[model samples]
Target chain A: MKGITVRSPARAAELFHALADPTRLEILDELKEGECCVCELTDRLQAGQSRLSFHLKVLKGAGMIVDRREGRWMYYSVNAEALAELDDLVDSLKQAKRARRATGCC
Target chain B: MKGITVRSPARAAELFHALADPTRLEILDELKEGECCVCELTDRLQAGQSRLSFHLKVLKGAGMIVDRREGRWMYYSVNAEALAELDDLVDSLKQAKRARRATGCC
Candidate 1:
């Protein structure tokens, strides 16, 4: 809850669900290089504007990315803070798994 | 590819999709304790046998768990190897995302 130590199965499911689409994953890939407007992303991804926007909304809603308006274009970038917390969660999971193994729980 | 450095959007999507459901996440949580049979899990989770089996199938198909037959009961445990790779993938993503930010790509 505080930093990647996910105790709620529902929350874990929601977070993972946000990353469960190919198109959305591709959008994240594009954003990996930097922030970009929807137009540039649409052009680079060669995806329809509407579909791209939908995926963007999913990622944004999940707190994976953030958007800023600059004149006519809205630029989107990965929410580094949010993503860092996700990374921390993964680390905690790994540790938990190891602890389980050590205790011969499974 | 070799470890958790995921290069394919499609593969990442597939892996994440396998973990997107609350039931599946619950199953993973149950397995975190150790190997369990369908009956034990169903009793603990208060879910129906058919639905639990379906979730188990999904987890197994994703290489996240393995099943074994022991006389009359079938047992399952987390595929620690696969899960470890997934953890590694998360680590790599964190590094990649950080690298992108440092270079002011976004």
Candidate 2:
């Protein structure tokens, strides 16, 4: 298991913000199956190219997904490292919850 | 470890949305230490009472935090079950990433 490296609350908030949208999460779900071309994402998500592109940009900006160019097409896939980082963030929160419970503070 | 029960992307998005704000994350950070009165959170986070209350409502609405009223004071703390559910959500994504990698898909 990777050691949890707690992120600053602001950084965590940024990452969570990126994940907070239904459209972006849908795009991620598509890419999770495998790398997908922009055309495929637009078709599968039933979103306009411009609309999908906007969400893609947000995911890419947050380091949640990575993109590559293949000739005229753009391919995207989930960033494994980002998912690992998210796991760490959750672990840190869980640890905090446990610590709080240990104190038995009301 | 608890088994991962995957949440729909929309549901995941809703939870993440509640966590997307820096102020909400800061409030969670303070509560992670132990349950705190609303007045203490307002003082520690340097947020106006109404503003802090708004964030608290969002957190509570998403089931991320629990609140209790004692006399005239309201107290807040992290919800351990919600953290566990978030852990599961991350686990599902990690599993997807692994599955994608195993397929050797570009």
Candidate 3:
């Protein structure tokens, strides 16, 4: 996975670290529908305001999602570009595995 | 991510958790080359035998890799089927994102 020089293991680790939490993943699932304000997300997820806010911060910090403020409402949505990067990284690993198989490394 | 009902968040969380550590990721990288005994992995990773063993156990627990023993040597390799399942999950998320965009979820 590393010898392919695709990306550093640290970056992959960071991305996975961000994704390790069930709550955070649930938050991402909600955002996948569309951008939504914190209040809406809190209501939909039935999570405490503080708890939802904490998870939102983690997702944002990992660049997995982005936020915008309109008036007093802060809206969040999936950061598609970031997710695409992660997708490509996983694909690279998969492709590498296939290549190894073709080379009879099984 | 979840509304699609393809897989549970807990399962996704478990997979991501297994990938969260840099050392574990490095161990996976080494295994990508093909099956290797723990001693060879330790030398390649330049990690203490016990430490490497610990990470290998974690990876195996998460179903990301499998181990086999021949005589006194234990060998580890990536679980290609499991990794393929992970690949499909990620691809589903990415496709869902694209579909959302097209559906005017932006």
Candidate 4:
């Protein structure tokens, strides 16, 4: 089994922190359907434009999501690499559990 | 592809919030070796007892780690179930990314 390694605890924490919000999770869910413009997300999420923008910024800052400006609209989609990294982080915890169980250390 | 379903955004956020701390991640790393008593964790992480306790509490509260009382000591270990759940959450995002790319939604 591959060992779980968090080379940068700060970076992992930042990624998790970006995921620690209901609004942001909703945004991610919305974006998961496909690239969405700001107006579409605001309507779908029923979030105020400013509030939605803040969550988008947080997700983008964490590299969890990517955005592109198309003329007047900004489109957003989930970043697959970041999600894979987060998956690896969770796998690390699972690996630790396996190691502890195997060693049965007390 | 299995769709990503966030049944409860609040609960997901709570779990992610528990993991959004560098100290807590460090603690998880230590426990990955095996079950650890409070004193051992304090020494290994170089964290004061109170601070450590706070992080432990958060992890425990979110079901990220489990504790057992053994006479005068409390041992901690990672919760495999919670980690699995977190992994699934991350997978959901990945699935979404795939869906978006497959459809090429704009």
Residue A97 deviation, candidate 3, in Å?
A: 4.4
Q: For residue B65, give model 2's deviation from the true position in Å.
A: 0.7
**If the candidates were sorted by their DockQ against the true structure, best first, what order would they fall in?**
4, 2, 3, 1
Q: List TM-scores for all candidates, in order.
A: 0.83, 0.85, 0.85, 0.89
For model 2, the DockQ equals 0.44
Best by lDDT: 4
Which sections of candidate 1 miss by over 4 Å? A1-5, A95-106, B1-5, B96-106
TM-score, cand. 2 vs. native: 0.85
Report, in order, each candidate's fnat.
Answer: 0.46, 0.60, 0.45, 0.72
Off by over 4 Å in 3: A1-3, A97-106, B1-3, B97-106
Per-model lDDT: 0.74, 0.80, 0.77, 0.85
Cα deviation at B18, candidate 2, in Å, is: 0.9
Candidate 1 structure quality by residue, lDDT tens digits, A1-101: 22233577676777778788888877777776567789888887899999998999988887888999988788898788767766655554554442233
Clashing pairs in 2: none
lDDT of 2 by residue, B15-52 (tens): 99988988988887777777888888877778999999
lDDT, model 4, position A59: 96
lDDT tens string, model 1, B1-106?
2323357767777777888888887787777666788998888888999999999998888788899998778989888877776776555455454323333222
Query: What TM-score number comes out for model 3?
Result: 0.85
Local accuracy of candidate 4 as per-residue lDDT tens digits, A1-106: 5666677899999999999999999898888877888998888889999999999999999999999988888988888889888877877766634444443333
